[model samples]
Target: MKTDSTDDPRTDVQTASDPCQTNRDHVEYVGMHVDDRPVVLNLTEHERLAPDRSLDLIRQSRPGFEWGDTGSGSAQLACGLLLDYTDDEAVASQHYIQFRDDVVSQLECSGPANCWHLTGDDIEAALASVTGHEALTPDGGTPTPSLPVNWSAVNRSERTVFQRRDIDHYVVLGEGTEEWLLLLCAQGDRAYPAPLDIRTVPIEEDPAPAVRELVAESNDLVEPEENA
Candidate 1:
C-alpha cells in the first residue's frame, strides 16, 4: 500500500507556511498515522518510503518502519532513513541505531491524525549529532566495509584462527563450534582486547577470504584514542 500527494488527503498539498516545505533538491520524509497504522512517504519522490532490508543482514529486526519509540520498528526506520539520505550503506550501517534513538524515537505524534516531517538537512544534522562526526556526502570518501560486523565481544571459548595487527587496529578471527567470529579491535587500551566490530561466518565456510577483505578495508576501523 502506497501513499502519495495525489492519493492521500493529508498530504495533498503543501502550505507555503508549512515548516516541512522543501525544494526539488531537498528531500522531505513524512510519517503519519493512517487508520491507526504508520505510513511513511518520501515527499520528494512522491512514493511510499519502505524499509531497506539489505541492512538487515545480521537479523531481520522488523518488517516495516515505525516511530515515536525505540524498538525494532524504529530501528528499521532509522536504517531506511540513513540509507535513503546518505545513499551510503557504510554510513547507514555505522550510525543507524544511534540515529534511531536520537531522532526516529523522538518523532512523537499527538494522535492517529498527527504527523512528522524531516528534511534531508534535518537528517544530516541528526546523524552528525548522534555520531559526533561530520555529515557524509554522497561521495563521502569512506569506503564501504567488506561485510556487516556487529559491535560485540568475543567468547572466551572461541579459538583464534587468524590474527592481524596493524599500527592502529587489531583484527582476529575466532573459530567456534558453529561459526567463525571475526573481530576488529583497537591497538591501545581504550578498547583493546574488546572488539569494536564483529562478523560471524558459518563453521562450514572458510574465514580466510573474509579476513583478507576486512583487513584490506580497515581504514574505517575505530581508533582507541578517538574514543578515549
Candidate 2:
C-alpha cells in the first residue's frame, strides 16, 4: 500500500494491492501523539485495490521532489511517538488517557486531516482504557500486545499486511514533554531510529472528560454487540 500526504489538510486511507490491476494502491495515514504515546485511529478503504500512479506523476513534475534533505532517499514517509515514564503508573496513566482519547475521537469522527496509527507502548495504555480491559504483564507494566486488539482496524487483510511491511515510518520521541526520538518501521518489522525529521506534539494537561466518555461509550457498545 502506498500512502500520500497532502500539503495542508492531511488524510488517511489504507489501500490494498489488486491482482487484476498492474499498479500499486495508495493510502494516507495521519498520526497524532500526546507526549510520546500514540493511538491507532481510523483506516480508510482497507481493501486490496490497484495503486494510483498519479502519486508518481506528481513527483515527476518537480525536480528533486522525491529526495529528502540528503537528496537520496525514497519518497516514503513514516511517523511515530515516544513517551518517557518514570515507571510510574500514575504518570503513564495520565499520558495514556489523553493519547487514547484523541485517537478514539478521531476514529469515531471523520478527521479533516489525515490520522496516523499509534504503534508503540505509550498508546497501549490508552487502548486498554478504550476497551475497558487490561492485559497482564510479567514486568510491572502491562504487556504490549504483539498485534492490535481491533482486528478490522489493524489487519484489514493480507494486502494491508504487505504494505505495513513494505513502506512505513517509525518515529520515536525522547522522554521529555516536547521531545521525541525518531524511529522507523520497515517491511513489517518492529520500529527503530531513522534519519528522517521528527515532529513532536505537546501533551495535554488533563483529559478526564474525554477519557470518561471514551470508556463509557466503548463499554456500552461492546456489551450489546457481544451479547447479540
Candidate 3:
C-alpha cells in the first residue's frame, strides 16, 4: 500500500474557505473504504544495509499460490498471510509468526518502516525514465502535482509507460486454514482501490517474477509520447 505523501498537516497553509465547508470536507477524507476498513493509497520503502536472511526465509516460505483457488492450501495460506500483515487479524498463524519475526528484526535494525509510495513526481520520473505512455497520478500523493494528470489518447497507446484504467492481481499476506486469509483484489497487487475479496492468493509459482513483470509492463504501458 502507498503511504500518504501529501502535505503534512503542520505545514499546510490554511485558506479562508467556509471553515464549515472545510470541516465538512474533513469528514470526507481522500481515501477508500474496503470492507468497512479504511484503505489509503500510500507508498513506502524499506531498506536494510545488510540483507536479512529471515526476510528471505519468510518470503520463501510464503506459498506461491494464486487467488480464487478453492482447492489449494497455498491459496488459503496466502490469504491468511495478507490479513496478518495488514493487522486485520488478531492472532496470526505459524506462518505469520515467521513473517512477523522477519519484520520485527528488520524494524529493530531500521528506525521505522518505509516503502516506495509512488507520487506524481515519481510518476513523472517513471514517465521520463520509461519512454512511451504518460505517467498518471490516479490519485495525487507526495509533492502534489501542479497540473492535471490525464493525457490525450494517441496512436500506439499500448507502448506507453503507464496505462489508463484499473489493474488486476491477487496478493498473499500469510498462511491460514480458510479462505478469509488472502487479500483479494482486482487492482494491482501492490496498491488498493484494488478491490477487496476473500479469495486472494499469491501469484502462481513466484510472485516476485510476476511483480517484476508488472513493473516492467507498467513502464511499457506509458512509454514516451511520439514526436508531434
Find the 10 residues in a row with the least total lDDT in model 2.
Answer: 71-80
Show the colliding residue pairs in model 1: none
lDDT of each: 0.62, 0.28, 0.28
Identify the leading candidate in terms of TM-score. 1
The top-ranked prediction according to lDDT is: 1
Task: Put down candidate 2 lDDT per residue, 50-103, tens digits, no spaces.
Answer: 112222322211221111121111111111111221324343342333333344
Name the weakest run of 10 consecutive residues (lDDT summed) in model 1. 135-144
**lDDT (Cα, 0-100) at 161 in candidate 1:** 28
Error in Å for residue 64 of model 1: 1.0
The digit string of per-residue lDDT tens for model 1 on 1-228 reads 666655453543355555554456888987877766788878898777776553453132545778887776787788888888787888776677678778988996543335688888899788768667432111222232332232122233434422332244545776676677887665565654666678898643435556655655564553323322
- What global local distance difference test value does model 1 have? 0.62
Q: Give the per-residue lDDT digits (tens) of candidate 3, residues 76-137.
A: 33323334233334223223332222221122111111111123342333324332322222
Candidate 2 displacement at residue 122 in angstroms: 25
Query: Once superposed on the true structure, which residue ranges of model 2 sit more than 4 Å away at CA?
Result: 1-96, 99-143, 146-171, 185-193, 205-228
**Candidate achieving higher lDDT, 2 or 3:** 3
TM-score for all models, in order of appearance = 0.52, 0.20, 0.17
Q: Supply candidate 3's per-residue lDDT for 162.
A: 19
